[model samples]
Target: MGVYCSKKEVVEAQSSSFIYQRNRTTSLEEQIKARCPNSSANFEDENSHSTKHSSEGKMKCTKVCFICHERVRLDHSCTNQMVKDLEKHMDKDQLMDILMKIKQQVSKDEQSLVPYLHWGTNVALIFNPFTQGLQRTELARNIPEFSRTILARENRIFCIGGQDSSTMKSLPTIFEVDIEEHYRIKDKMNMNQARFHHTAVYDQKYDFIFVIGGMTSNSMGNQFKMLSSCEFYRVQQNEWSIMPNLKVARDTCAACLFDSQWVYVFGGRVQFEKRQLTNVIERAFFSRIDVSQWEEITLQGRQRIMPEFNVGMCHQVNDTELVIFGGKDTYNKQTREVLYFDTSSFSLIHRKSQAQSRKSSNVDEQLSQAKTLQKNYSTAQITVKDFRMPLEIEAPTSPFQIANNLFVLGWSKETNGIHLLRLSLINLNWKEELDFTSYLASDVD
Candidate 1:
């Protein structure tokens, strides 16, 4: 008659057999290697000569361990003693309770919105709130090209025409990057004109990418030319078509689409028979088939001073609202001026408060200029406020919007490195996201 054994005894026996068999297999492998010193079997991982061995003396596959295959169980005596020791030393309620706490300690990282900065043709800096509870951190990833105007839609990033940083020559090539896949499809389509420092806006309703005023190189690629010509790419058709040109030729300007019907361009260095920073604003109507002529509009506010090239502006939380801030003024000095443009009040002039009107002695003179400008054209109201930015940030470039936050990339004199700054739309406060001083030091080393 056969005698039955307890579950613990059965587990212990299975574990012992597995250990003995594993040791014996290793010993046989060492013997085979000793015989063939220069053969491929001398290597560690490959099973180059294992297939030739008889099944009886075949080595155990290291990948097929006890944890993976349930055939080999844990030794009951050893595991039981470990549990007893842990309980006695720590005085825990239960082993599972401790494990659950550990698992809950570190939350899994779920990045809903990712903002990317072009570091170079081979690397990119990504802003994320990491798993370790850092509010916002910069992660460097080796990736594709450098682009001046980049527009994001869903999980894809479109890199439009821009001058090559290495050669400083304009490029017509377009690159589409799938951030999730960590890959880029280059030369998606070439633009009609090679340009850089341009403004691009993606129209989601019609799937068109509108490329606006930008700077291009001359025939010799030695001198720069400001462009007033505009064009757009039909994403669905994979083709480019010319659009109406801007009245004011400028580069490094701000452009935003309002109500999916109107495109507004404003605030940049302009050359209208003379080289000077411009406060001129222009708007045009864009449709599925055709775009109207660009018409100048008057921004109703105090005597406005335009920011230098590379002004940072973003469509605020409200679709009709825009926030423009952080650019060098006409004096070539960085300014903290922030303009809140409300397009919902289009064509309707906002009268100043009685107190403000009383305070301003030249209210009638300002009203007369506004009336003359608004007679035959549309008008938009803007309120200017001075907001403080960190001292290190200088030369802020065109900003892009992701949800309610606007991120600007600029140079930092204090740290002597690149700084990514984030401005909150709700509170209108700025904070430094990440500084690349340490990374720059390592590169120098």
Candidate 2:
């Protein structure tokens, strides 16, 4: 500058001087503390007075009302270090008004979200008949205890009451799996009783899972007994209540819901001290959420002995007929036969029919009433028919229906494998769907 340098040279000299100062080496920690003064307590106290006014300019805080549990945002600009000025300026009446508005807004938001939370899509566990295997679905993590019961409701499968794997005794543990969520297992409230080989049915109207008869051994394990007792699990409340005992104690019985008002239990073995097996069909009537009772119904005009001690598969064909398949006969030999029951016939025996009969008095009126009653009686007549399946299934499990196709899961002696048999509702023809040999092999390897 003293030599009268040009403006470009003067600028370059200043830039060089600044670069020399910045290039001087320093400790990493010292450099950090130098550049970030407020990051440490030493620099904080050093700059406290200088930065006091700037930091006190404005601060945002949250306030909550103890009376209504409502929260609101507040701001303060006072520089006084010793006092909270936001609460002092608040008016109780104004805050209460704001609280009411907030509550209304929250209620509206919840109303908008309710439908999506309550409405769930329908899902089913799909099995491919042609492939004879589950369709790329996740298997449940835990295997069921011996003689377990499986029930389906609202796209979730509830597995309840079975023999414990560790103790070889009955378990009260309840597990559920959501079919829509890759069959993920979830823990549920335990049942009041530990049991196995029980029957469970879902009541759609009341949203309850009725757990019926099952067997459990004594503490000594030397004697085995069947359970005539029954209980129901309330889905909404996650609670269980005792239902009226079955007319007869049963184990390994088939149960189904009829007309949404009755649970029909079929052919199960009753064990006495002498181990005698008795099979009977009973219907449980549901009148209210808290009350249900079972009554025996006669199977009229049947020639074949009712399958006793047989693990038969039962399915509701309609309001009128239910088809039962594959249980052992009284001879203790597995049979390849199908049985059909006319369920509507049982309604004719109800108290309503007796009331209708007592209402008619005059001869002409009685005659006309009899004619109409006869027509209704003819339609209500219970018919049981035994048909032979193409293949014999030993102790078939429950039958599941999709569309018009009826699928029965059972074991076949010819193939020596667990097979799924498909029966067409249209033609009543039987076809082999899947074998579990390959599925089991893959699981083992």
Q: Give Cα distance to truth, residue 130, candidate 2, Å.
A: 11
Residue 65's lDDT within candidate 1 is 20
Off by over 4 Å in 1: 1-112, 117-121, 129-146, 165-167, 271-275, 301-310, 344-386, 391-398, 412-416, 436-445
| Model 2 pairs whose backbones collide | 132-434
**Residue-wise C-alpha lDDT for candidate 2, range 7-99, written one tens digit per residue:** 222223323333444454552223323433122333224223222224321111112222333321112111121112322655334433544
By how many angstroms RMSD does model 2 differ from the true structure? 27.4
Q: Lowest summed lDDT over 10 consecutive residues: which window, candidate 1? A: 377-386
Question: Candidate 1, after superposition: displacement of residue 73 in Å?
Answer: 59
Write down the RMSD of candidate 1 (Cα, Å).
Answer: 22.7
What are the C-alpha RMSDs, in order, of all predicted structures?
22.7, 27.4
lDDT of 1 by residue, 1-445 (tens): 0011122222333333334453454432232223332223332222232222233222211111222232111111332344346547653234334544443331111112334444453444444432212122222322222245354445345667776665667778776655655444545778998887677776766778888887887766678888898998887677899988888888767776766688888766665235467777788998899889999876555534333434445443343556555555566555545555666643322223322445666645554444343221111221111135664344323455543356676665456577767775423447677664444323311
